[model samples]
Target: MNSGIGPMVKSQSSIPLYAIILILCLIAIIGGYFLSKKYPLNTNELKAIFEKEDGESNDITEPSGDIGNSYAAIDSSGVESGEHGHYATPLSQVNKHNIDEVFHVAGELVDYDTADQVCKQYGARLASYDELLHAYQHGAEWCNYGWSQNQTAYYPTQKKTWERLQYGKTELEKTMCGVPGLNGGRFKKNMKFNVNCFGKRPDKPDTDFVHPKLPKKPTKEQSKEELKHFDDLVVIPYNRKRWSRKDYEPHPV
Candidate 1:
């Protein structure tokens, strides 16, 4: 009987096929992993992760306040502090045109009429370059060397008083006073304050409720260029508002 158990000669090398298969499987797994990392399989899920992260960032969803859309300094209001102080409003936000009412506005081209209304609402006119200066200036008017403050420190806030103004003029005076004079209208609140404390409160400090600092007014020169414009239908920071001699020379428009 021929023994089938005798040493059998291997017909083919199983090592090559097995080794090649193992290598191919290892390569396939590694390649698959790398590809998955680069191009994920669950595309929607990956997209969702990115969307969630981006959506949560304030920079992405927050409105472009008076500040424009771009990296810039943040104001005390936690919005963008614009360049040249030309405020930026989000296209989606409601804006009252402030440019129109600024005794004389400068910096950016704005919807003057809308800005005018906005200013009126706040009892603030479009800040002429001079007026804007009040928000930041320290020391004497026209004293460029003097310390100036930022918006955060500029106004504590508009006063809660029935009359909220800065020039110390009564709200009635502001309403009644024609250009170049105090408001002298028939409104009871206006007429009453005009008689009682117009001169005493020549400077409006929001009735001392909100931000309480009365910024020194603009210099004379700044007043001429910035305020004179108001007399001509153009709004400007008035010169009478000037508080010091250093600001005697009118600033260039």
Candidate 2:
């Protein structure tokens, strides 16, 4: 019993494996938090970089016919397709003063009243005949028939293609150019069609202007004189050698 070397006791200074691992994990977490605070992440910039690397684009090509109906769908920002054919930027971002711009508002066919209301909802009005024609000259083309001012429906075409000709010749001679009036016959008020909206939305109601007094109806003789004057100023000059013999004779509206 003199050589007593009883049971050995465990060392109290040594740390447990589990405890050491937990401390290291805490340190890593703290370091990561500080690093994130110093360098914030930009999702947009990252997306742009990834898109660039992938050769992806946000620009959409111009679609044709009914297949292009998606062009009329409005985004959350309240904009459809952009100027001409590209569908990249929201129209709200474009210059409001550019009168040449034309926007197709309705993807589905709608009556004249609905079309007008739809355009108004967009803070625009039905495009005028002259405005549509000017837009066509400036490279605006849409296959769908659209409601225009004066209760007319017109669809712009770059050329007189057979598909376009199926709508019919605007003139008797069939040689007229530019935006031809739809030959499907006189447009009915309830007839459904697309809407072409023009102009920027007014910031406020126009209260400064007063309505002009209505003009008195002219007598039959006065009407005839006015008709002759109109023929001289507009009809004759416009028709010249272009219109047919039937066009020279006045037809009842």
Candidate 3:
């Protein structure tokens, strides 16, 4: 009973609680490294995670080079480029032959402003005097007096029909639609008349210069009202049959 050791004391853990926690964290980190090596995140996923951590927007759009080049080409084309949904023609590319091509839109005795709007609706503009003359020289024949630029009206005809002759009998009519001139006569801006439209026709045609559809014809009642302005003897047929296939109705310029 008198031994030097009194009783065996229980042994305590040599590692502290903090050191044990550190060892567990190292094991978890090593396992995660292996898992990441087996299944790595894609670029988009990584970017999303980084964006979320940085509190940045995830919406990122790359610039388009083709779209930029297309705009540049349009700028260099020397055309009236469309803006805000309004289209126009490329006048710089127009040639002499294009000047000789014209179309007509019979008005219900509309004034210059109305006539201009009608032409624009059909994707065209008022023809110039020289353009009307060139068109006349190229066998463009219309029996209706149409409003042109410079507050003038003109009608081109190859034959001296009774319809034209009736108006030619008067002194003023002779001066308006007579020989030795381009068949153009000045008029008041408020005077009602038809419309002579000139379309854009480039020397080298392309899809950029597409022709617009023709406007709808007036109804029978509308035509009757229009007929009241002109005598029956001088009424010209306002139908598609009267227009030639050669006439141009291009997009607005």
Best by TM-score: 2
Could you tell me the C-alpha RMSD of candidate 1 in Å? 21.7
Mind giving the per-residue lDDT tens digits that candidate 2 earns over 10-123? 878879899999999999999999988999889888888898789998455441122122222212111122322222124354334323245655446888777788676655
- Those runs of model 2 whose alpha carbons end farther than 4 Å from true positions after fitting are 1-100, 160-185, 201-253
- Descending-lDDT candidate ranking: 3, 2, 1
Model 1 ranges off by over 4 Å: 1-11, 14-19, 30-45, 48-59, 67-152, 155-253
Q: Model 1 misses residue 6 by how many Å?
A: 24
Residues 77-147 of candidate 1 have per-residue lDDT tens digits of 32122232222222234234423211112123223234344334334433433433333221111101111
Positional deviation of residue 239's Cα in model 2 after best superposition, in angstroms: 14
- Winner by TM-score between candidate 2 and candidate 1: 2
Model 2: per-residue Cα lDDT at residue 253: 100
lDDT tens digits, residue span 1-253, model 3: 8688788888996999999999999999999999899998699888898998998978864311111111111111212332211122234433433232466654256888778886666457888888777665544544457888878898765433223333333465544334533566898888887777776332432433222221234578876765755355755444555554356455599
Measured with C-alpha atoms, the lDDT of residue 160 in candidate 1 is: 22
lDDT of each: 0.31, 0.53, 0.55
Shift of residue 60 alpha carbon in model 1, Å: 3.1
For model 1, what is the error of residue 5's alpha carbon versus the real structure, in angstroms, after optimal superposition? 29
TM-score, candidate number 1: 0.18
